[model samples]
Target: MTIQIKICGLSTPETIAASADAGASHIGFNFYPPSPRSVAPELASELAAITPRSLLKVGVFVNPDDTLLNEAVRHGALDAIQLHGKETPARVQEVKASFGLPVWKVLSVETDEDIAAADAYSSVADLILFDTKTPKGALPGGMGMGFDWSLLDAFDKSIPWGLAGGLNSENVADAIRATGAPLVDTSSGVESAPGVKDVDRIAAFCKAALDHD
Candidate 1:
């Protein structure tokens, strides 16, 4: 029950309220416009202000330049920045320095070779998020697709990492048991539709994540 649960891609006030009510430890705001879940920085700021201090705020981006990241930090009270793109270790260092916020580096995992990049980010990332790789023509993360759980079997990683992609109320515990992830993330998994978060599903997902610990 010690694992952290992050409910990503929250847009509406109703869902934001449900996120804390459901006992989620963290809430994520997507900055990528292409994503159906994307919310404006001003709207994110409004949501963050109302969010309980007990819930941490995470800002998601995809290889964004410094300007957009700075704007999010200035407007939305983000406690962490989730780099869900092809950002290098050097960029990770730069983001941490420039924003003065804890940085999370997300690595799309498909095979054992993908785990090698973990070492490269180990020294800099506050946390490493392992998301299932997107299809040939899809967004990077939050594609509502999952990888084989056995792929993460016996993954003895040195850095702290989270498991994401296609995880929901039914499969989160099994995913955690297989990957030994210290954290669990959700987006489309808890949605009634694309970008629409379901409060009940959010609660169920959180319960499953906590039970795994």
Candidate 2:
């Protein structure tokens, strides 16, 4: 099976080009100001401009209002919007309706109940991304913390879904095997430090996810 790969939290032109050159299907631009990987819409637009047309540009936001969303979409020319905060299904629908772009809803998974909650967004969200839940005061994702992969064994797969959290070149193949994830996402796992992406790691990660059966 061909697995799609998303390299998240990309800010610079070099890393964005690296992700696209390494065969990534999507590239994520973080808009959450508190996160280490955050970037303004103008910078994201510059980075997005160099991205190849084959790859989708995804804007990552957390509890964003219409103004931010409008600015990001208009400036960044995003192909999709990824909600990584406390947005409900209604909000997901509203974002989709307003932007006319595919919406990806991130679910912070720690238990079977978290996986089950995806049902609520099956109809509204274009895709459901399962990521690990961080600490109370920590960033929403890209902390390189993974949840129990077995928790997804019994997932109903009501809609298109992807796997995220703690994925690196060393463990992504195993993760794909464990959950049969159609798509795999990573940010910190491919970074040398918080928000610093490594080109070699980016290439290795995409290779690993693509080579997996």
Candidate 3:
């Protein structure tokens, strides 16, 4: 089965190269400043420059406005925009229209009700991402928190979607099997520190996801 893997919150050249070399389908750059993985547009641009064109470059944002998206898209050379915040369906459409890029809205899930909320974004977003809901006063994502993957078994996945939050090499294949997620995203799972990605972990994650059948 060829599970698509996205290694998110990448900042350094070594990690970026590791993700690409490890056969990740997508690479993400964080634009949210509060997170340790966040990077400036210029720095993201430099990091993104080394990525091959075949690999999709994603820019992660938190309720971003036009200014932030524009700068990040231009400087980071993003291929897709991931809105990991409380963005309305209208906001998702607005971003798609404004940037003319594929927009991925994140659905923070804790209950079946949360998973069902994805329907509201069905027509607006090109893709939907299921991530663990962060605790109050905590950062939006990349917290290494996860919800019950079994909840997704009953979800009506009408739109293309992926899984995120707390996934690692050891458990990613199991997550995919439980949820049947075609795509899987990870950040802290492959990191040695808050913002530092471990190359070996990155490689292991890709191998594990791909080897899942």
Note the clash tally of each candidate: 1, 0, 0
lDDT scores of the candidates, listed in order: 0.87, 0.94, 0.92
Q: Candidate 1, residues 1-213: lDDT per residue as tens digits?
A: 388889999988788888888778899999999999998889988888888898899999999999899888777889999999999999999999988999999988888778666888989999988888887779987778887767665455666778888999999998888777878899999998888899999989988888875
- lDDT measured at residue 131 in model 1 versus the true structure, 0 to 100: 88
lDDT of 2: 0.94
What's every prediction's RMSD, in angstroms?
1.4, 0.8, 0.9
Instruction: For candidate 2, list the clashing residue pairs, or say none.
Output: none
Tens-place lDDT per residue, model 2, 90-202, is 99999999999999999999999999999999999999999999989989999999999999977876479999999999999999998999999999999999999999999
TM-score of candidate 2 to 2 decimals: 0.98
How far is 33's C-alpha from truth in model 1 (Å)?
Answer: 0.7
The RMSD (Cα, Å) of candidate 2 is 0.8
Rank ordering of all candidates by lDDT, starting from the highest: 2, 3, 1
Better of 1 and 3 by TM-score: 3
Worst 10 residues of 2 by lDDT: 151-160
Off by over 4 Å in 1: 153-156
The TM-score measured for candidate 3 stands at: 0.98
